[model samples]
Target: MLTNACAIIATAASAQIIAGRDASADDWPGMASLQTVLGHSLFHECGATMISPEWALTAAHCVEDARIETGGRAYQYARADDGSLVRFGVLSVAIGAADLRRRGAGTVFPLSAVIVHPAYKPEKPEAGNDIALLRLESPWEGPVALVDGLTVVPREDNLDGPPLVVAGYGRTEEDGPGEEAFSQTGRQLSAPKMRLQEGYVPFVETEACRQQIDSLVARYGLSDIYTDVAISPDSQICAGAGTTDSCQGDSGGPLVYRDYADPPVQVGIVSWGLGCGRPESPGIYTRVAAYADWISGVTGLQIAAPQP
Candidate 1:
């Protein structure tokens, strides 16, 4: 979540953009922004990745109590009935190159429906089942490939985890002037555009995630803040502690691999963390490969493997 007024109230501080730089050089045709609109204005509360022509994946928390700003004021909105922070109906989306840095420029679309994983329980702190699928009113004709398919790196191959690329339009930094540098663009409706930042961080194995979390829990006396699903092998990936990590508005975006030449395949979804980029707090992302079959069921589409 964001520490700023208009920033997302996610795990709270949309976190610090830190070392992540502009992602314009990278080709992410499947990129999408889940906009939290108020009246006639809109602001991106979280990042989303289009996994299919009609589906975009993001964190359920992104839409829950999503942050918004209008008339120079910022506030949090959540309608438990619809599981969205916005009151009105119809959430808007911009797919096929929806870059915030580009001033919300991209293919605009309407959300016909939103389906959060049935198992997901937002009240639980363990961060269980944070994944959700936004059903586009229609389908996207974007250049990026849908992230659905059987192509995935097995858990056994997760040795030492692996490096991945993350992108989003969140707070630029944890604190100081840089933090508010983008606040106007990110939270204010004046410009209504924000900068998109990206970074590469290696995935931490499940065992490692548990160990580190345990140590941190006990050391910091944070047992009351964590849950069994915090870093479960079947559901999450812990990545990067201090060097670089995702935070705040970065939630619900894609954690993908860039080693392959055929664009990149998303392996994780931005979940939660203790705070921003603390030395002991690693970013938690929802493991994507673990839910391939579930995705197919939701979209009624086949999973395609990432090609080299």
Candidate 2:
């Protein structure tokens, strides 16, 4: 997830990568990174969910800066000096029936407009109801699934079981001191099931998180380390160390709960993690259930409970 503090820097790095690659349709994973472009150059970046042939759900912060584009293997954001623009694009557009994924098939349409949440506030990264809706230029012609609505999974009731799948493309580790590099793209990382909590979820303790954060800051002097101890109720699901963790570039990806007989249903959106996957740090996710009404109202899609 690109918090306000790290948004600018990450956007630049990502733009370079997006413009340099030739991504394919099949590479568009359900919950993948979305790169915004301006005149063939990457401008901004955010995570997106492929909800339907023509629709994607993502954080408002991502689209707040550029126009939406699809069909590329991956999304990239470029820095301002690289001639990139960081701004939202389009207001609203209907989804025309088209299938860009088919080989030898090329489809192009203009976005009508963008619909952002009325209450979305970018400053508060924790109050992560920062959701948004993108009306595709044309309706995608294929099968797409929507994420499931909020349904509580009791922490103690479900434990020592199968590992929950937390997927994203963020930094593999905390930003190191004197380090001036970003993580690679298209690399899907997973954290197995760890500890879960009902009330306040504890990430790596502040001291520990600070140690890593301080170390990076001292070396890099960039102050990129986000060692915040608490996550707001709106944005994160407290899952402690064992296996499950979130990292940079993972924002907007899904923290899915998969069942044997049914497909995986997304329970949360990758929002942030403590000190880049430290041993005790639990990754935070934007609570999908908290914004069910907002999500449904904006997309005109119903949020249903997943069937077992």
Tens digits of per-residue lDDT, candidate 1, 74-181, equal 243566555544554336666643344344333767676667777877544355678877776667776543352334434355625455777776655554232222
Model 2 Cα lDDT, one tens digit per residue, 1-308 = 34335442221011111101222223233543453323422211434566765567665555555443453222222336565664433232111111111112222223444555676664334444556666565675543434655323223222124334554334433342111221122222121111111111223333444454345445544443433333454444544452334444445555555543566555556554434434544555655666777766766766564458
How much lDDT does each candidate structure score? 0.61, 0.42
lDDT of 2: 0.42
Model 2, residue 137: distance off in Å is 1.0
- The deviation in Å at residue 26 for candidate 1 is 4.4
Off by over 4 Å in 2: 3-29, 41-44, 66-111, 150-162, 176-235, 240-244, 305-308
All candidates: TM-score: 0.77, 0.57
- The Cα error of candidate 1 at residue 3, in Å, is 7.5
